[model samples]
Target: MIRLMQHADIHSVFNIEQQVQSHPWSLKQFAEAVDSYQCTVIEQQGQLVGFCILQPVLDEANLLLMAVAPDQQGNGLGYQLLEHSIEQLPNQPVQIFLEVRESNTAAIRLYEKAGFHQIDVRKNYYPNPDGTREHAVIMVKACSDDFAALFSSP
Candidate 1:
């Protein structure tokens, strides 16, 4: 099931974030996201398995963060979480943007499959645990006329 994130979900979501991201968002960040962003979580068998955070301003939206539990990845949960979050944006966004670490090819491919294309690269945008920095690939997608229809019905 996919639904709006609740305060109770923070710990579960943060666990996945820590497990899957080299640089994870802090608990305070998650608290703020739950308070301010369009945060959605996906549950499987009553366990939170994935989540996506988005920020919408007028006709544009930014995918702030997204993640799936390591054991649950490669099973389409991330894609589902992403598409659902986009469709649920408060405004009918004409454009959506997101940035991903250059080394995360899986996420890049997932975004590409969802119609997002790379528009630019931010040099050394993300810091690694090893003290190295990596580029961030900026991707954008035009939310055309059939933006909602383009996604398969759940």
Candidate 2:
């Protein structure tokens, strides 16, 4: 089940981040996200499986972060989380955007499957351990006046 994240979930969320990414967000960063963004977590049997952080900018929504427990990958949890976040957006002609590390093919594929298109690329947008930088693929999906299409029968 997915639900709004609380202050207590930060520890687990940080642990998951450490396991899933080479460079994880600091506790302070997670705290700020919880305080400011639309943060949500997916839980199974009381264990967090995934989470997403989003921010609204004018008529656009930016997906600031998203992560799924390494063990939960390829199980459609990421897709479900993405869909849920999109559904929760305030009613507006909003354009949702997110950036994926260029090397993360699986995440890029999932974003494409969810109707997001590659809109641009951010050169050297991500850090590398060897003091180099990696690029990011910027993807976007426009929400219709009514987002029912996102959940309606196909």
Candidate 3:
């Protein structure tokens, strides 16, 4: 189920963050983010499977963070979470933006499949676990009336 993230969900959210992200956010960081940003989690059978964090303004949003349990990736949970996040955006001329590590092909593919298009490249934006640097691929999806209608259609 896709729902608003609660304080209790931060523990599981932080666990996934540590397991999947090279530079994981600290528990306090997650707590602070949840306090400020819009957070959503996918829970199933009473366990949190994935989560996404966003900073939204009037008509656009920045997808600051998203992660799934390492063991649960490639099971469509990530796509569902992404779709749900977009679907729940505030009613307006919505656009969502995000950055993905260049080496993260799986995540890039998921974003592309959900209709995001690359806009620019931030050189050496992400640090690798092996003491190297990776570029961040910035992507955005503009959800104007036609775009929203495209997804809402049968």
For each candidate, give its TM-score against the true structure: 0.92, 0.90, 0.89
Worst 10 residues of 1 by lDDT: 145-154
* Model 2: per-residue Cα lDDT over 1-154, one tens digit each: 9888899999999999988888899999999999888899999887898999988777678988889999888999999998888788664435789998999999899889988999899999999989899999999987765465445737
Candidate with better TM-score, 1 vs 3: 1
Best by TM-score: 1
lDDT accuracy of residue 92 in candidate 2: 46
What is the clash tally of candidate 2? 0
Q: Rank the candidates by lDDT, best first.
A: 1, 3, 2
Comparing 1 and 2 on lDDT, the stronger one: 1
Given candidate 2, what's the lDDT at residue 27? 91
Where is model 2 poorest over a 10-residue stretch in terms of lDDT?
144-153
Model 1: per-residue Cα lDDT over 30-109, one tens digit each = 99999998999999999999999998876688999999988999999989889888888876687999999998999999
* Local accuracy of candidate 3 as per-residue lDDT tens digits, 1-154: 9998989888999999989887999999889988987899998788899999988876678888999998788899999998898788665436788999998899889999988999999999998879889999999987778467757979
